[model samples]
Target chain A: MIRLGRKHLFEDLPRFFASLGGIVFAVQLVVVQLGIFFGFVHSSSLLIQESRADFWAAAKEMQYLEITLPVPYSWIAKARAVTGVAEVQPIIIRSIVFENSNGALDYGRVVGFDPAGSLVHLDDHPVGDLREIAKPGAFAADAGQLSSLGVSGIGAEGTIRTKKAHLVALVHDTQPIISPTFLYTSLRNAVLWSPAMIDEFVRDPFTSSFDINSPLNFVLVKAKPGVDLVALRGALERALPNSRVLTKAEMIDVTQRFWVKRTNVGFILGLCAALGILVGMVVVAQILYTSVNEHIREYGTLKALGIPDRLLYASIIWQAVVMGLIGFIPGLLLGLAVAGYAQNARGIAIEITLPITLEVLGLSIAMCVVAAVFAVRRAMTIDPMIVFKA
Target chain B: MNEPRAVIGDSIVMTYPSAAGPVHVLRGANIHADRGEIVLVDGPSGSGKTTLLSILGGILTPASGRVTIEGTDVTRMPRRERACLRLARLGFVFQGFNLLRALTARENIELPLQALGIRRAERLKMIDALLERLGLADKGARRPAQLSGGEQQRVAIARALAGGPVVVLADEPTASLDRENGAEVMKLLCELARERETSVLIASHDQRIAPFADRIVSLVDGRC
Candidate 1:
């Protein structure tokens, strides 16, 4: 049956490809939209998803990683007392404005932590000169946002919240999805720039003081090996009444859900992906039905040859499948290429994972199958006796 | 010598729903064809010759009557069974030659064998032999549209007889051919009927091929 259908396509090459063109475009639509959707899901919670912490402690009522309020710096010690707790790294998160060379201000999130023991990465490299921030004018920020984050250049001096700051080193792959830029420096420099956090008793970066009452934004924690995170979460929740406790996985999920519900990125991309599939299905069906309609006499000839409806249906389906399979090859390659371009040009990371590959292939074939249904009806309804007429 | 009847029909009746009412196309039509015989049925337009051929070929079911091929009463069978009977025992050549325009002459001839699920190598051999026998050996790779009308009819005849059916049903088998081409097609049909003992029933408006037929049945106003 497939052989017959293929032969037919060769005889009517122009019409066959005209039909194939619609399905190919459909494949591209489904692939590109699905790729964009994956990008949105990943970038929404990148910080939480990339961290090495087993558990996270943030201010009570905090719904996301990027929008944290300060909690008592002493909450780290209180959390460490829990049975499964092994280590805690106190951190501060604050929104600050960077003064561009022109003195124009650009807003970004600033993160401060003990550089020697921080779990979050600065472009997958260890922070150089961990003690440099104690100089009162030194800090490191992602370089990808030189324009967006309002940084002048590498080794350029700048100010954050009226405090002198230096861009000692630039980082990569650390651009926060929600904020235009990110700053990572020693806890002392981050405090000087964040006056609100300073008033709330931030831990002094220079003094090795565990008793400092600074208001830290978060605590990154590691459970003892063999400890269940759920149990550890319950323990931390009980120990620190003023903070929210969550496992790293749960925090990632929470952050993603918040962004999806609170922002329109997820819903918009999701709707587009669904629309792509629906449009692809309709376009392919139209192409197939039109081809069948044009070849009614050819189908009638097959019927007169004693070919049953089942084989006829199989032939039509096989024709669609051939077109779909050919179209998907380019669609997948071009879609991934576009995703790569978008990531480079606009800083959006679109990932094509194993499940998505299988899903889109299945979707391509399924749409072709669905498209053949209209043709099947026309083929079966053809009267074989039409060939007997003049 | 009298040969055994390969096809038989008795009192066949057919009616179609029209804008006005049911129009009876075949009423009390009877036809028969013996082994090694070429039967011709000629009539004017709307004489129901084509409808009678469609019924005897087992494609169109009659309102009432029996159509028997090789002693099996196909009208009593279900649709699938009747189709199976057609696939294995009957062949048809239509007015337009009815070759699949997509396939070459050889591929068209192999179509019926393909329906029977014949092996590829075997089908090719059968196609090759038939194309040679029909004087189209060199034209096997040409599509129906690429061939002349006479060549196209020969290809259709090759396709119909490729499976060695019990009988061949043709409707206006030479209507579109030139006088020379029409005579060639008639000669081939007669030779195939006699040499293979395959019966042939033709419904046509052209009387030029009548001298080749072993029997003639006239149909007028849906009765024969």
Candidate 2:
């Protein structure tokens, strides 16, 4: 039976390929749309992965890194006193508008960290020199920002008049460090340039928000080896009632849920993919239906010769499956090519996992089976006596 | 005539229900064919010759009466059962030379064997022998579209006989061919029946084939 199925498939190879052209085109549309959605979700989480932090302590109800408030700068000293805590650092984060070479304004994140502290400078990538940022008005920018600024190396100078700062070293492709256009500067410069910075360190007389003395948006905490994260989380949650301390995994989940899950992007992309599958299925069903109709007399003849309805049904299904595989292979390859092109041209990362590829192929084949089954209803109803009448 | 392999119908009455009313296609039609005999059913168009042949071949069920093939009552069986019996014991050649357009001559002949679950090697050997015998050995690889009317008929006949069925029914097998091609096809049908000892039944108005039959059954106004 398998051999017969193969023979029928091979014999009708031209028809199968012609029909598959539609299926492949449909599948590619769905895959590429889904890939774009995935790329967006992945980009949102890029910073969290690059941070390489064990835990983040943020004010209650922090949705993403950019939206959170800073804890008191002195909290670093108090946190260091806690047992099992390796180090503590204070950092300032703000979003500001900067002018491009074309005089167009673009929004970006500005990060201020202490040059000498282990907590502020956590990246493993080599920074030219610590003293460079120590100079007044000096700042560092990510490669994306540098490119957008139409500048060449770390020595290129650019100004953020909104923050009254000057760029010094340019960090290339440091994604999570600053998502949009991150500019790094010294803590002293951060405090001096921005009007939003509070001078008192203890309290803010104007705002009634959480403790004003808190100097960092999050205090990254690393536990000693062999320590249970669950147990430590429990202890920390109890100790710090004013803030939330979450493990790396928990933070990732929170970020994903808050950002990716709530966004309409995934839903829209998924709907597009579903529509593509539906179109492919319809195309297959119509092609099979027409093919069966065209061979009605042949079917009658076979039936008159003692062939059972079950075998007849099997033959029709076999043809469909063959067409599906033929269509799917090229569809899958074309989908990958489209995704690769999109990623290169638009700077979008589309990750093609093995399981995902297999799943797509399986889905395509299943669609073919469904289409074939639709045609089987007509094939099985053909009367063998039609041959005798003819 | 040799021993009878088919007792076609006993007082068979077939009525088709159309929008107008019940139209009787066959009335008390009886046909019998002995082994190795060529039974030519002669009738004008719409004279119920095809209907009687259909019932005899187990391809149709009469409103009343029964058709027995090789001692099995097919008309009394369910439609699926009748179909299976027809496929196993009877083969048909239609007027259109109904070879599958997508299949080659060899593949068309192999269709019935495939349905019977015959192995590829065995079916190929049988197809080769049948093609050689029909003088179509060089044409087996050609699709029906690539063959002439006479060649297509021969391929259809080869397909019908490939399974070595007990009985073969042909409906106007020479209707689409010229006189010369028609004679050739009739000769092949007669030769196949004699060589294989199978009952051959042909329903046609062509007088050229009448001489090849061992018996002639004349059908008129739904009666034979």
CA lDDT, every model vs. true structure = 0.79, 0.73
lDDT digits (tens) for residues A20-105 of candidate 1 = 56666666666767777666666666667777788888877787877766676667778778898878887777788888666878
Model 2: residue B133 alpha-carbon error in angstroms: 2.3
Best by TM-score: 1
What TM-score does chain B alone reach in each candidate, compared with the true chain B? 0.95, 0.95
CA deviation > 4 Å runs, candidate 1:
A12-24, A126-137, A195-214, A225-234, A242-244, A278-283, B1-5, B71-73, B76-78
Where is the poorest 10-residue window by lDDT in model 2 chain A?
A: A200-209
TM-score of every prediction relative to native: 0.89, 0.84
Residue B139 of model 2 has an lDDT of 94
Complex DockQ per candidate = 0.57, 0.49
Question: What is every candidate's alpha-carbon RMSD to the true fold?
Answer: 4.3, 4.5
Per DockQ, the best of the predicted structures is 1
